[model samples]
Target chain A: MRVAFGEAILRLGEEAEDMVVLTADVAKPTQVAAFGERYPHRFLNVGISEQDMVDIAAGLALSEKIPVAVAFAPFMMRAWEQVRSTISRCNLNVKLVGTHSGLSASDEGSSHQSLEDVALARVLPNMTVIVPGDREEVKEATEAAVKSPGPVYMRIGRDEDVKFLDEPFRIGRAVVLRDGSDVAVISNGAITAEALAAAEGARVDAMVIHVPTVKPLDAQAVVSAARKTGAVVCVEEHSTIGGLGSAVSELLSSEYPVRVRRMGVNDTFGESGTYRELLEKHGLSAPHIRRRMEEAAEKRDR
Target chain B: MSSAVELADLRHATDVQKLKERIREIRRSILEMTSIRGLHLGSSLSCLEIIATLYFLKMRHSPHRPRWKDRDRFILSKGHAAPALYAVLAEAGYFPKEELRTLKSIGSRLQGHPDLRTPGVDAPSGSLGQGLSIGIGMALAARMRGSRSRVYVLAGDGECDEGQVWEAMMTAAHLRLGNLVLIIDRNGWQLDDRTEEVKRKVPLRGKLESFGWVTYSINGHDIEKIIEVLDSAEKSELPVAIIAHTKKGNGVSFLEGTNKGHKLKLSEEEYLAALKELEAKPVCE
Candidate 1:
């Protein structure tokens, strides 16, 4: 995931002279080491202070530089006030790349897990929240973020996520992994792999929509899909609140009001375990989504 | 009033009386706006003359071309003190003087803090202690772009309690950004209590100097002294730090030197008294 982000970053640098990157002591871990090695002047490592890193990024952005600040998701939370005021308030061109999102830091436990990052980032005005499905989506979203006008929060998993899409997907355009007519399964980030697996178990026509950009969401596409299917099931590896499930719920509530069943981590803290075990323990497996979809379909039949 | 001469000529001319009148007018604007808006009355009074000197006789900012590439940039890092900044910007013709009345009103671009979306503001500031870093970024950009434009940032004394300010200071000095100036509005008071009691930043100049900054101290309300020091520092070869000693709520008699007035809105009687006191003060040096 980090390598993909790095590749997209290099491409953005070639396209935009204003592009700059800052890291809060996470350059190596986020795989921005090569960019740092290549563009030493444009890259900054501001020690361990995430708040200062954000402030410096905003400062760099004040004078036409498109600053991309990279850090662990939990550490990025330390700079929320700066992010809200200096970046979002000013509407500065800064993209915040938060690595080890959700329970991707499973062994690192709840301290490093960014379960609430989406909720926190979504509330800030002028902030675009994106959680890419895999390495391929991360690359596409990073390229889009460079052209994005204002602040953006992009979540990328620490582990190598399941890659379903072989082609570059347009950001904010949900990719339909499976084409069905009865129900649409909406998922994002690393968990879209599980949604694809669960699609095989559907008794009725089922489709899986992959959303990379959670904010400035493809509302038109989601509404159209839900209206066609009459029912939607949203899944994510993170908590049900303010993640993929909540984003879909918000969209459904206003634009595409449909019978929706949200399958995600139901407001629980992730434990110390491997990523696979954590997903299984939290019922974020393909079978869990399949079971939830069948039950929703049964209710609609009644 | 300053010699009946244009702003460009004021740089070389030391007309203290006319400049003092400019400071008084700035104070008048602050008092009137604070009475109407009921916000930043204390902080506005605190940095009245500092604003006057920068806009009137110190900085080279063009109102017609706010985004002029060669113009100096100022960031109010202590953004709650935006009334002073707005009053200065208005006097500089960044906006109409009458529009100052829209302060803190719904849909008014003059928010409680300095918003870059507004005409004169270079950066959005309010969440404290981040302005210096932004100035550093600006200064670095100017250097990289080979432009001689300078960046100035004003931080509240209390705002120094934030760790980000220090980080910015370190970055600026590390970069050896001679084009940057950091002014500490040493007002001694914050929202809740006195800065000395809350979080003392004694030897403030020493701390900045330790970061390889060329430091200076001056009476913040003394426009003449401020201009002289700033002029000398601008010629220096290192990033400059000016610890401008000021009284919180300096212009309002009832509020001056009082911690209670740091963020308080004036009542009807208090407003009337403040007006009377401002009217009695000498208009010029």
Candidate 2:
């Protein structure tokens, strides 16, 4: 999923004349260094300065340039204030792509892992938030982000490349991978692959909906799915406090008033472990997703 | 947001007398605008002459056509100095002088800090230590487009305490952005107290030179010196940082170099005296 963003930058750099790529010293890890190598003049490496990268992107945007800033998701949050004031406040067209979102940082421990970027980016007034589920979506979302008229924040995973999506990607649109009336399992980001597995692999008879755009969410699709199933299971690799879970709950409770079970990290920092172990510990693996889906389905019968 | 593109037409100050008169008018406007809220008085007062010289003489911008493609860009990194910037911008016809009274009020285009909502503001700024980085971005973008336009950023001396300032300094030097210039308003005072008292930036020029910039130390209030340095920067191969030495509250006697100038805590008598003092010819040594 990380390299997919770099591949997209290479493809788009040729067509988009005004596109400028920037990274805060993690160019190789985020895989944006390929663009740097291909077009040295268009790429900027603000060594270990995310705040500088963001404000500089704002400056570039003001001068009729589209700057895509890539970085580790956790460290990029260091410049959240800069994103708020310099980019989002003024509504500049700067694309921000974050790698290792959620616990994908894995053994890099709690500090490197990011579980709150979705909430932070979602709350900003002018930012469009996207969390791609697979390698293909990361590339598609990166292209869509640059096409967006204003600011965009895309959260991508470190290594989850579960490529199940075969449909055309569109902003603010959800793709239904499974169809059922038992319950609705809705998710964004890499966890959507797990949600799909819970519905398809386990024969759970639950509707699986992949929502790539968290902001300007596919509200109509989500509400329709909730109304059809009468129950919802929200899954993501972020904190359940204010991520896809909060977004789903906030939308469903007001619009359709369905029973929603949010499955994600319950507001605790992650611990060091293998990626699968951490997912199990945080209740984000496909088994946890299946358990939550079954519980929501059983409770609907009551 | 106007789509109209026009050639740059600027009215340069013909002499020192004209420039000083412009500076005096800017001070008067700032004094009147901050009467109610007393917002950022010392910060505004310190950078008037530098801003005045730029708008009247140095910058090539079209007032009526603010988004003109070929125009030079100015960013106020020391955004608390909005009163000074607004005064100069209005004097240059970016917006009406009548709009100055709406500062800090509800529904005013003018905010406490410089906002892009206001005409002629290149980038929105209030938080310190962010402007130089923005200037570098603009400078690089212009070069990529093969345009000769330049970007100027006016920052405060006390604001150097922010680590991002140094981070931006490194990038600007690394890029060798010849189209960018940074003017540090060295008024020797900040909001908390004296800059050295809060944090010592005494060897500011030496520090900047070490950071790989072509540094220049100048009397910030001197119009001719400001013009000379600004003109000379165009030929350089690297970014330029100008440390402009100035007094906190330059025009009025009681307010100059005093904490009272930081924000307007003046009594009616002192306020009238300030206006009367500004009515005289500007003191340029």
What digit string (tens of lDDT, one per residue) describes model 2 on residues B85-204?
998999999999999989888999999898789999988999888998888889989999898889999999999999999999999999999899999999999888999999999799
lDDT of 2 by residue, A76-168 (tens): 899999999889999999999889889999999999999999999999998899998888888898898898789999989898778889886
Checking candidate 1 for backbone clashes, the offending pairs are none
Q: What's the lDDT for residue A133 in model 2?
A: 86
Please name the candidate that would achieve the greatest lDDT relative to the true structure: 2
- Segments in model 1 whose C-alpha atoms lie over 4 Å from true places: A201-204, B1-15, B265-276
Tens digit per residue, CA lDDT, model 1, A106-188: 89898998888888898889888888888778888898888878899998889764678875766567777888877888988
lDDT of each: 0.82, 0.88
Which residue ranges in model 2 land beyond 4 Å of their true spot? A201-204, B1-13, B265-267, B282-285
lDDT string, candidate 1, B113-150, tens digits: 88886898998888888888888778877776788888
DockQ of the candidate models in sequence: 0.61, 0.73
- By summed lDDT, which 10 consecutive residues of candidate 2 chain B come out lowest? B1-10
